[model samples]
Target: MKINNYQNKRDILIVDDLPDNLRVLSEILIERNYQVRKAINGKTAIRAAQLSMPDLILLDIKMPEMDGYDVCKELKSNKKTAEIPIIFISALDDTIDKIKAFEVGGVDYVTKPFHVEEVLARIESQLTIQRQKKQLQKEIEQRKYTEEILHQSRAVLSSVLNSSLDGIAALQAIRDNSTGEIIDFRCLIVNPVIAKVFGKNKNDLVGKIGIRKIIDKIDNNLFNSLVKVVETGKSLSTDLYYQCDSLKYWFHFIAVKLGDGCSVTVKNITSRKETELELKKINLDLETFSRSVAHDLRNYINNINFAGNLLAEEINLDGSENEKELIDIINLSCDRTMSILEGITQLSQLKSEPIKPISFNLSPLVSEILNYLQNNEPRINIKFMIQDDVFVNADRKLLNIAIENLIKNAWKYTKKTDETIIEFGEIKSTEKLWQEKIKLIDISPLQFKQKSIYFIKDNGIGFNSVLEKELFTPFKKLHGDSDFDGTGIGLSIVRRIIELHDGVIWAESQLNQGAAFYFILATD
Candidate 1:
């Protein structure tokens, strides 16, 4: 058997014991542009088909050594060539049972001395059917793959919806008959979270249209906004207040449109609202207390200062140096006490005021504070190292206070030192460097991070590093009143200001050496 021809043509193998029969069939197939293989016996036919599988096989039953029925059965049994259509060549009055030919995987059996037209027709018909089966099988496999992908996607979506912490719901808009205006929403799909929030079972909520109506009644704008989202395909996010008999609640919700429906997520914010109200009440009390302390205590201190001045002018203290010094001490006490009270009042006001950040150059602000300090204390000599063109996004009024307090502290602490120096600049850092400890190690070699880190370094009498953590705690101080003068509230106020701007501030200090403050703002 030979099958060397390789082209876009159908292949057929013809088997017979007679050389004439084999030659006749091969010529007829070749004339029809069919690649044909001739075999004189069953053994040669089976080997040829297996080696290079033909689309069809023609077998002769009365062959020597091996028969057509056995060859067809052998080819059918093998998985690779099993589907090749096999047609038996047999006589009408054959020794073998004709019914048994088909049972042995024969598609059709031809009579002895078969006609050329009849043999060609049988081969064409079986080849056509095989092509159709392959086409159908390919379509079926593609459909199965698509169906599996769809199933997996649905499963993942179901998992996300069910596991969400916030209440999740899918609602289809119910429109009016004439205007097509959405009057209400019908729950199409709801996750377990939605069921829990609505205080009902998930199964019960589906297909229900009244749940959203009850919720919409709590907030005047909720229904209208939901309808708008579905109609315009725009998203809506807002806070809603709901009150019922002996029940009050606050919820933050967002709605996004999906075709004629909307997907919504609701989060309970009742605790947050309650806390805000409580803070408001506390702020009111704090404001009143600050006013009373300012008015009542301020007048008493003013009277002491007045009386001390009058006594010093009225008395004749000739050779009475001790008496004059006592009077000076009383005057200084009154001034220091008033400054402390003013610090407390400023601290309270900052706590209550809202912060609004704006971009501005920082160098000028630092220079102004430094000039004010130097002008007031003309005898003191201090050097300032300020970075130019440094812009920061922070509340102007609040930042002024923070910078003033820090610079004032630097001035006070460095009074005894041989030379005073203060530097302000930006320190670029990466996320990993955010956790970098401020030790004796240099930081110039570190790579820049995504966010800008700023630092203020002062060559002043620094506090012990052991007390650094407590430095931001209210009313906590490291140095005593005889050594330094401060209310110990400035650092705490600075900490609060940093937190409000979504930033962090930290410092490293060594006693009698120096201190540096590092901070990062997260406005972006």
Candidate 2:
């Protein structure tokens, strides 16, 4: 129905030797919103008909170079323009001329000085017939395509059912006459695997006793599941353990509704189940050992810290310069070691913690972080640009930590520069952006789905491109600790947090020009 109303107007071509006739027909058709093309003679009319292929044509019986009858004959002979409807409009009213018009493939004849209403009525009737014919042709082609697809699908399904290793059976529901309840299931079809599992030939199993009779020997749950599938037309699956003839076994059963019955599949998973139990026991033992080691290490660090403090207090101002310097170095080393231990502990805890996502505005959070950084380093010229009301759904605490680490890293790297420029905002994904950022090789611009891409850009002494791949690896450092102070775990923690929220983060940078870190958060 929608297809029938696709086009708002039809196209008409009017052919005549007289200029006045062409002008009059063109004006009438154009006024009705029908596209009109005109030709002064039959030769031009034939060329126009072949080029544009108008829906309908009006031709004069008498024309220069070629008559209307000859033009119609040439058009009907060509396959490209054969189906177009043609109506003759001329002053000739003799019966012979009218007969000749019909013989030359004209659908209708309109005498000259014809009534305007009659001409319009005829055109509308011909256009309506043409539209219906086209619709019928489309329906025929669609039906053929659908039939071919159905045949292919059936072949694929049959091959899969016959070749599967798992036992498969198709059952038809047998209902009680009076109660309309599913009493049992009769085996309509069974693959070779199913026959072998039941210790019977395939031919002997088809159209045999109800499946309930066989399954009841092991467990009644299988029968009940089949009954449920029939009643609700929904699939059911379960793992079953049973013993038959002094042999123990485990089976995974699945029943799915099909037509008036259900199809069932059974797979033996005894070996896989045993392997899983063994692995679970091994993991429990490893967890206990790790806890014991961590407890002992914490105690040792605490005792060493206390002893160092006591030694510092006992050493007086009269002590040698070298002795004092060595004591100070020992104390600083102890503190640094403690800091590294704390970072590692936190990183490990993130793996076990569950994330709680909530909706919040990102703009205010970024503003707060910037304010804190600015207060601590008042002399640094740090500028930031953030969009307003940028909302996201994520774990607020984890996101806060990630953003803080990134901003701090930018600040530290840009310390040597005269002015530090840090910009935080959103940008749309377009074809041009995709070409400019070649690192995004896997993502297409069309797949962005209108989601915002947020980035933090800074003018800093960026790292070498060769070491970019190791930026997110734990304890991976490109520079010496004295040059830049960090535990080398900040980016790794940031990456894990982003992954937990089903997001992505990547960076692009040059040696000393600048660096930009881009990320996307789940908006829904």
Candidate 3:
């Protein structure tokens, strides 16, 4: 049989042993625009099915070599052609045969001596039914694929949460059962590990707040992070080192953003933190040991060189002046080593000591420091402006050290006939922005009725302006040792003190012009 010339029509295989029947069916189907193929026997039909993969098969029950039942069985047995609908066409008009054909995977039957109109109608009806079945099967396959993806996604999320070394939780957006209002309070799922850590069951926590409410019960930081993640739908991560009972744990938690909710995981890094602390302790001990050895060596060398200088002075060397020169060299070297050792020891002390702050009157303290500096250097004139009745909360000793260093810096760097001007006062008002309100800071408390703005200006031989940032670093020298007669740790000490007091200090200078230092202390 030849196929009809139909555009995009479904391919059908007609299998019958009769030549007249095959010819008639082909001519009628060809006029109906269906692309049909023919086979005289079941063997030929199965061969054609494998070759062309027809969308439908029409088989005659009584045939030579192989019957239609065997052919339909073969087609239905194979996975490739099982879905193709099979309709039986035979002369026998028995209902038992129809049931048997249906059981063998025959979709419909056509009687022998078939009319052209009846055959075409049956063909059209079966084809329509087959198309619907194929569509339904396709939809079922697509549904299965979607379901597999969802299961894989859940498995991936579960593995990620379970494999985490830190405590983690996941929440979904659901309505509150009691209030009947939509809220981000439901726990869709939780891994087994988190359940064990929190001492809860995953089944019991399905509709709860997971670990967030549990943490809130214990007044933990997780509550805040959970709120932020839920409100903004953004990832929030932080390092939290906490102790439970006697065991210490360090956790870095990250909340990943998701639609309608978030997935949070925490990585426990207690071992890493312990390693860091152990390294820090070792470095501290080494630094302390180094400083101790340096101190003892400097003292011993200083004493030996001092005795050599005295002996060289007492003994007269008439022709050996080189021996005295060597003694002088030893003394100078010892002095330099002692100075360096002293600098290191002082810096170590600064790092070790805690800031001890107390309430004190800053006015009298500043005045006393200035008076002492003035008496020591009478050649250099001093212009002082002190803010009266000003008080602040700070360590008086540290503040004195800081102010004295600045004064000394001014004195050492100022040119000849230069005057140092020091003024003191408070920050008036500062404005801060917030989501709902603006905050204003008034420096009227602590009896500092007038906001203080302390400044030190000098007509000094200023150094390079490029070293502004490194000025507060220890041993960061701007002037040569031959020109300046002091250690370079002065500004560093000043910066440390200012930071301890929660204040800010900065310097402005130009090459050979002058230098000015400003200190702003928050009084309120």
Candidate 4:
């Protein structure tokens, strides 16, 4: 256990009439890293301590001027120093004096003709108790600070989130007190902004099911987005165009995932969303007009070529070859224009498409994808070791696209001397998740027949470990485009798919050594 910085040192004040007794006590305490403050008389002792406080006080019961009782009373009178522990050390054998010493705020008494061991033991015991007391004080202060922070945080967050015209809420998973089993999570806190959007009071929402319970009462589109944030554990900021009570309203929501909970702020973006829709509609009309114009021009060019053939039959042979060359150029230019238009249309379609999840066996998909790559490229010896029965509930088409991209890159980047190897399987255990996250996998779960881990290993030209963070980002390429031909979207897509399935993806690699992609596909 580690002690805090404030409570690391002990301070002891020894007040005695005898210089020899003070000297002996000082030596014993200073040897143990205690700061020793000495005073010859009661008056001097109080003055010495007032200048700098000590953790524990050792006062002589009998003194020449202003006895120990008077000194203890003065010290205890000041609120700044009242809590300090005072121990009486004296030659008085009478129980009445001992009782009087305690009445003046003394904690313990040391009988006269002090044994070195006895003094040391009592000092140790008092210091131990002082340490414990200081620790408890620190804990209480921390709890108070935490409560204050929570209170302030709740006020600020609620105020900011609820003020928006868009409905926003916070939700946490409720658990059973006895068994820790998850019960239904109800809304514990909500802001006024959320209340106005749903046409209800904040008090009525204390035990409700967040936005899910009243989405139809507010806006169904906003409800769907709230659901997305809960499932994904990712921040969502989007503009929604929907209707509530037969009146159209656009809401922009910014939701942050809080690990089994969430906090969202909604902004009334109705005007902005309406403007965006109008602009989009204008752009669509322009696109339709362009396509129509292109189609009309193609027809006009065809008619011109058809008429040019009739003119060729009636004209003389002079300049005929040049005329034919001009006609051929016109035809090729039209063809190129059509191809460019088609490609643009395809790119637009890919951009606007939504992501959908579909389930399929990954084992056959991996094998078939690898077989196709190997068959096309005979020189690359692709060795794949997939645990046969492995299956996952995810978007098969997207998974195939991601795996194929990784496999293709692996083949492309294989070192001349190294054999390309790929492996996959499932891992299911809390211990394994910790191990994989912290690089200290607990193999103990294997003895008890726990869920096994699944991983993907590959042997290819690896990059620096320092660059792993940016690897999954869109258009972030570790290797040059010429060295490995890619648009830099393969790993980005893979990460997106894994994220969609609520899984974690990480890479382990070193320069010149191969890399492995490890991911855990959490099952429901």
Candidate 5:
């Protein structure tokens, strides 16, 4: 994994009483791309290691100052150097000293005049084991992080559902038994906002068998949006303008797919909507009037200002009056519109903004995304193989978008599998090693040209290999929209985000098997 700097060579400390032994070991480790440090005796070894920690240590069993067993025990006692693995090398082949070497925290024991191959193999083994332990620890921490995010999200959702000003309802789709058509939605839960809007008791609506004629006048457009979300399991957010005999309002409707149905939130945005329209019309008419008329009207503003002072003073006398409520609403709407316009202006010019990159761990981020996906489909028992401590240097926001799209894509494709397994990890730096270890997908998409290749793999309904070239093309699809309900822009968006970080994405798959996506970012 790209947990740390993979380009950096491993460091090894060799301690021996004889200069010749240290020289020989140093050369061997250096040849294998390891940074080697030498100390002629135990005391010197301990001092050198305490000053600069090495990845692994080779210590002689017998020395003038102190034996290797004592040296190992002392090193293990120190918190900073405790994790460094030590392999004891000495002339003493006695089994008793070997047991003592292990008792004192020596990872392995090697006799004197050991074969070069055997010594190298033992050293590599110890280092590999140490790396694995660190990886496991990171994975455990990431799992905890995912659980915490899930718990916090559910809590916040509960709070919003219970206390939000918006009409909130939990619904279950009533489907046709034979053809699986969502005929209507049954209210599984409802809050006071929703109850008040429909003019029904909360208790009465809890088990209602259909979309409870919202406000006694449900529009066709609103009904269609609800059905579409439940059918396709997609989210919907729209500003809908509604008008009736007594009501003229705009509602912001948001529907998110929950289980077999969807949760809906209806926000009344009539005041803001009306203000926006009124201001736009006034600005248009004023500019036109300026061009048409001969008079440059400065006196009109004074007259309006004088009228405003009279209106404000009169309204302040009766706070419950209609004029007072209208003034309050207008003031609120103006302030909200200003803030919203500022945000919209900034967001619209996306290319003008430069990305801010930072180095961070990917394990927790991927875990959080996976947990969210699992919650959406609580019935799916997906086995996740998330590599630990995977670190990346990129714009966190852009990278988050990339990771979420990729993971959500994987989650969607794997929905049909009887036994689902999704993996988020990286290919090893060596191609030969990772090729053999890449089992997350049925077919391989493993490319280890870089030091490491980040990957997200899934055992899902894979796409056609012939469409590989179009995988990241905007709106290009390997599958029909009828079969998989998506605009086919998800992968394209992921590619754009990855490209912004100076990276490339690739995919490979066999039909009906599985697919794997690989990406590698350029290092600074």
Candidate 6:
């Protein structure tokens, strides 16, 4: 049988061996605006139905090779065509035959020479029921998919909450009955880590009101902060110290409001607090020891200088040139020793001394120091290249000390040369150099307006650059006393003075090639 366009119509298949019976059913269904199909034999009907599944099937019980019962059985056995509603119309009208038809997955049974109206009614009823069954099936599958997604989400949330290192707990606020004001909080959920800190199992803490059991163990501040967060809906954080029996701990508590309750996280900070206190005590002791040592050594050096002065006066004038040279050496040694003691005393007091910053011209100060050095050493030829009106805001006395140390070191190192040149001038620093200096000192560069890069360059014999790291360390000498005379504390003092004024100092040099000491001071 030919098929018509069934796109907008429910399809119905009529199966029978008699062509007349098939024609009659198809005429009735096609007149009702349903796409109709016809199969003459049971095997052909099964094949056609499987190829294009129909909304309903009308089968004749007795057929050529395969009967309607066998056809229905075949269709029901296969998953694809099993749900198509089957109605049997056959001449075997016995009660047993009708019962057998339904037993083989037939929906309704009609007698042979059936009424066309009855057939149409039965077909409409079955189609309505099939649509309802499909809709219900779709709902069931969708509900199953939704339930699986919900299960996976819950598993992920559970894993994240349990895997946290900090102690975590969620609380529900308990309010007064009459006033509707929050009176206490009941624990809703708690991670295992928090339960361990309180010395209890996680299950035991759930649904508990008021943590009276562990109240004395932890500081009351933690509870108060949580209460405040719940009432005001504001977050709070603080450090708490806990001590119970032999156990002592420091805890940092953070609480944030959530709905009518709050969530809290706790971390132990005992080791960190202990380390800070220990370091504080060590620094205090070291400062006290340094002050005592510096005082005693200064007095001893003063006495030695006094004794040396007496020896120089008592020495005979008509002595060997070597004898006179020995006397000169003793006097020079005494002066150097006194200078070292003074440097130590100055360094020891740097921390205690308060900085009194004032605007002062640096050019005049450099000139003054150079003039004093010239008066002391008349034989050496000295030259300078100082910048005019180089102003700086720093402690006048400290700045003077730093400049004097730099110039004196330059003069001492260049003593062997016929003509010595010491240049004191300011150089413009690039943004890259300023940034690097800020990083070295670990301070904010944004606070500075402009930096004054001053350098004290000398045409003297400079040491190797490899020893630059140890140059500013106390008692760290690069050259021996026989080669260059110094106490090795001058540069250290200069560094300290510059640091006190929020400045940085460094040097660059090579063997036998002149050394230049550079310092950066903030102008604003």
TM-score of each: 0.71, 0.56, 0.50, 0.49, 0.40, 0.52
Model 3 TM-score is 0.50
| Candidate 4: tens digits of C-alpha lDDT, residues 1-524 | 34553366688899989899899889888886777889999888777788888989999977887889999999999886788899898899799999999998988899888787787788888878978999999999999999999999988877776555556666765556998643444676677876776678988887776445565555556555655566677678776555667788777768776777677666787887788889989878877786687678667766776666655654436657777677666655555555445434433333334556655567787788778877887655557787786766665665676677666656666744357786766566556454554353232433324333456667777889999999887667898755665555667666666655555567778876877776654431
Task: Please report the candidate that would top lDDT against the real structure.
Answer: 6
> How accurate locally is residue 514 in candidate 4, as Cα lDDT from 0 to 100?
78
Q: Which is the winner by TM-score between candidate 1 and candidate 6?
A: 1
Model 2 misplaced stretches (Cα beyond 4 Å): 1-159, 167-288, 352-356, 430-451, 521-524
lDDT of all the models against the reference? 0.81, 0.81, 0.73, 0.71, 0.78, 0.83
Q: Is candidate 3 or candidate 4 better by lDDT?
A: 3
lDDT of 5 by residue, 478-522 (tens): 877556656566677777777676667778789889898987776
Provide the global lDDT of candidate 5 against the true structure.
Answer: 0.78
Instruction: Name the candidate that leads on TM-score.
Output: 1
> What lDDT does candidate 3 reach at residue 175?
49
TM-score ranking, best first:
1, 2, 6, 3, 4, 5
| Distance from true location, Cα of 136 in model 6, Å | 9.6
What is candidate 5's TM-score against the reference?
A: 0.40
Whole-model lDDT for model 4 versus the true structure? 0.71
lDDT of 1: 0.81
Q: Per-residue lDDT tens digits of candidate 2, residues 1-524?
A: 65554356688999988888888888888887788888988889999999889999998988878999999999999999999999999899999999999999999999989898899999999999889989988999998999899999878876886898888999998888999888887888888877766667888878976567777866877788778888898898887786767777677888899887898898877777667668767755665565566667667777877886777777755667787787787777777766676667667667656789898888888888778878887745667787888777788898888888788878778877888888887665554564455355356544445556777888998888778889889989777877877778888888888878767788888888888888776542
Query: Which prediction has more favorable lDDT, 5 or 6?
Result: 6
**Candidate 3 Cα errors over 4 Å, as ranges:** 1-7, 18-20, 61-83, 96-100, 113-118, 132-159, 173-184, 201-213, 220-225, 234-259, 267-473, 482-524
Candidate 5, residue 174: the lDDT equals: 87
lDDT of 6 by residue, 256-329 (tens): 99888888888888899888779868866877887687678767777876776766666664567777678778
Model 4 misplaced regions, further than 4 Å: 1-40, 51-55, 78-84, 90-95, 111-121, 140-159, 162-167, 174-185, 216-239, 252-256, 265-267, 283-524
Of 4 and 6, the candidate ranking higher by lDDT: 6
Candidate number with the higher TM-score (3 or 4): 3
